[model samples]
Target: MFPFINRSGTITPRLALIRRMAEFTGLYSWHWTPAEAEAFTSHLRSGPKPIMVSTTRGYEIPIQMFCAYISDSRYGWLEEREQRFGTVPQQVFHEWNTVLHVAEYEGDPRSRPLHYDEVQRLFDAADGRAEQIRARRMKGSVSAIRGAALVKTLYAYAYGLRRQESRGLDLVDLRRTPTNRSWN
Candidate 1:
């Protein structure tokens, strides 16, 4: 019944919700209940990987959509299920049980910026690659060394430049200051 699709013509997130709901409802044979919905949501939150706030919030959308779909009389889901299972599907993802999206940034609390040690390791790895290429006297050793150094510099400054901006940067963008320092 869900004809939802994204701009790319792929199945929308609603399909995943339907599949998960089916699993929880035992192929639509078992009567769907609030407890079952809660259990399903809890199972999702209790996965091995730590659940981010955004991910937890995203999980609610599909369930809410499904609940809305099944509960709406216009969909005829209630009557159809009543005929087959002698029970109507009720909305389970009410505000009381679902997490609300109140904050602008809902990322995982445990996520943080990379440590200096991690950045150092990244540069070391890049340098080691450049050195290896140089040692082998490869044809592209010069370009490889320059590329590695450029990448390390870009990352160190946390420029966060897009592909176009990085590619557009040229010698003209670099300026030498009175302090004998160069800036890009």
Candidate 2:
């Protein structure tokens, strides 16, 4: 019954495993550099739930830690950080896992609107070559900025949805809210 509810056609057990894996490994993945992770976590603390909790009606279980948004701190793969430091910081990993669990259990707010500075930091933190290419593509136009903005927003929203669904939120609505509304 729950299987049919999956918009992505994934099985419930598989979804459960994915959510669990993200929960267990998110702290260790270095998916974002440590600095970025710290910043992202800080942003959450400064803003909304820090953890978004969502549930399916009639279900006895609830999912947790839906998303792990990284800030612009140490921006690189986990391995790089590990290789450089010989180990990942436990405190960082702990906080990351905690926030991720919250994002997973709670429905992530669709758009975490970023200010210009944050966007710039994200650009710097992302792959250097990719950022360069993206910047070049922008060629300094309002359209370029708009395009980048759309991509970032979409990426964040998709990540949140995936994390939520993995945790059993099983979100079905991908519909965009009115543009006039703020996503913060």
Candidate 3:
């Protein structure tokens, strides 16, 4: 009735953590609680060679996905778990326990787009800033104008630029593309 998420990139390491967690906690991973998962991560961090943030996040995702898979209502895993065992599975690996200080911005739901009035207000504010700078006889009128144009362009066309993308912009990026129409 469903397809598996084929999102394994580069490599998908075995869930060797399950064996480790079982050995560490003296319980199977299915029996381990959120606290145990947290402890496991903490243990990794406190080890002689600590893991990186990205690697830690990578570790958490598989465990989290496993819990999610078992607990999903449609899959009948929960029903089977409840019927056979007196317990139901829950998602133990969460934002609080896992690596949140990601070097790259990612994996957030699109929350609340700007309303029509809000969008207009933002563009107006950018334009107004440039006008204000010019009216005050500011030395950086050209910079302010460019800034206003940049803000408008970002909102209107080049939306969803990440921090690194914004920082990586150059004068060449601002150059107009060549039109196919013959200029001769």
Candidate 4:
């Protein structure tokens, strides 16, 4: 049986404040599989952040665009992490050295192209100087979409198209000039 009207509760702001602070600083526990836990710890023992293709133009693009532009080897990093680590590992931070050859024209995430001149510019800037090159190698994940699949995904993203399934483009199609390209 419970006691009747037990008035043990206090309304002091100081006690409330201390309780709030404790909650704020407390280490909230999360359950993870062995692989996930290992990967999380691996993250703590990390190195560098991924070098994403950011623009000084004061704009942001969906990470999917960058995913489409990079190589299959990079994507494999993501796949393995997903399989072994049970989460996308800290590989993004590891890929600090990579540079995405972004296109000159910018638009929605679905249809922008990796620009020709911009790619050249990025390479020129990264001329292997001690300061110019990325300092540390980090880790992260990317879907291993290469060749035609990559081009199609990027094209759709650049043009603002949303397809349920992947639509691979021919290598020759991607090689065509900007004028010849069409989006649906």
Candidate 5:
């Protein structure tokens, strides 16, 4: 049954979860209703790992994929199950019970955005560090200055440039106008 899933044979781990779901629901079959599916999901959610990690990617996605594969006509699972058990497997993880993929940013709250004062403080600290390095005539003052300048440039143009754009920037990418102003 597992061999029919994918060409690569890398679905063993996922198949383990499906087996666990069958055992949890006590159905021992793929032809489970939405109630059983909900129960299975709820059981997984109440597990130890689920308590630590709030996201349902570990439990929900694999179950949903398995249900999709069983319900799909192209896979012939529905026809085969109907012939064997006189029943067809229905999609259990519907919109009502499943989490929706709405937001692009699923990062931590601390990573959201720096406040205006926080940004000012960051720039001040970077500039102060650079100045202190210069005043002390440090051996790696040049590198320190370069890093500070890079930080300032990134912060200044953070609104205009994407993270990759700033990271992939080279010295040649910066153009100096007649007024000695640098533009990326």
Candidate 6:
């Protein structure tokens, strides 16, 4: 139902899950049944290093979501597939075979994220330290400012950027944008 789900970024991982499910069932998509999915889940749970419930759900979500996307009426895949393959894609996943959302942060307590206020306080402390260094005309004032900027930038793009990668950046690596006419 959503455009983002159709994008390559999302589809690639979902494709992997789809392949695994197909491999497990030894059946094509149209012939799939919820029983096979349940068997797959059981296999995951009984493995030597039995997967965590959450990890099993991670595999289930992608396959379920991708199936739902293809089965949607607006997507026209049902008609196209039925005509070409002589069968429609079946959604093997069901509530009975998949995990239900109950509560979050079920993992290690010590690894929990900081609250919003704590994050804000951390940023404020970084900026204040930079200002303190600049006020006293300290030798490392520039470095302090750069450190604060790195903190903010890391927080802004935390998923993609790393602290060491940011530290390695040079002024020469930045260039002016054509439209904005500002160094980036």
Number of the top-ranking candidate, with TM-score as the measure: 5
lDDT string for model 4 (70-172, tens) is 3245546656656765554221212333333465553455655546775445444433332322343322112222332453345443542334433544455
lDDT, candidate 2, at 145: 55
Give the CA lDDT, 0 to 100, for residue 178 in model 3.
81
| Candidate 5: Cα lDDT at 143 | 82
Stretches > 4 Å off in candidate 6: 1-16, 27-31, 45-58, 65-90, 103-114, 128-138, 156-184
For lDDT, the strongest prediction is 6
lDDT of 6 by residue, 41-155 (tens): 8887795878766787888887788777767889777888889888887787887778776657644467656667877897899989989988998889899888887776666
Q: Decide which is better by lDDT, 1 or 3.
A: 3
TM-score, structure 3 vs. true: 0.47
TM-score of 2: 0.18
Instruction: Summarize candidate 3's per-residue lDDT along 49-72 as a digit string, tens digits.
Output: 887656667778877877787678
Q: What is the TM-score of each candidate against the true structure?
A: 0.52, 0.18, 0.47, 0.16, 0.56, 0.50
Taking all chains together, the TM-score of candidate 6 against the true structure is: 0.50
Compare candidates 4 and 6 on TM-score and give the better one.
6
Residue 32 lDDT, candidate 1, scale 0-100: 66
- Comparison by lDDT, 1 against 5, better one: 5
lDDT of each: 0.69, 0.44, 0.71, 0.37, 0.72, 0.75
Query: Looking at candidate 4, what is the lDDT of residue 17?
Result: 32
Model 5 per-residue lDDT tens digits across residues 7-87: 354577788878887887888456588788778767666757553122555567788888787778997667778898888
Clashes of 3: 0
Ranking of all predicted structures according to TM-score, beginning with the best and ending with the worst: 5, 1, 6, 3, 2, 4
Error of 2 at 19 (Å): 28
Provide the lDDT at 82 for model 5. Answer: 84
Q: Go through the candidates in order and give the clash count of each.
A: 0, 21, 0, 24, 0, 0
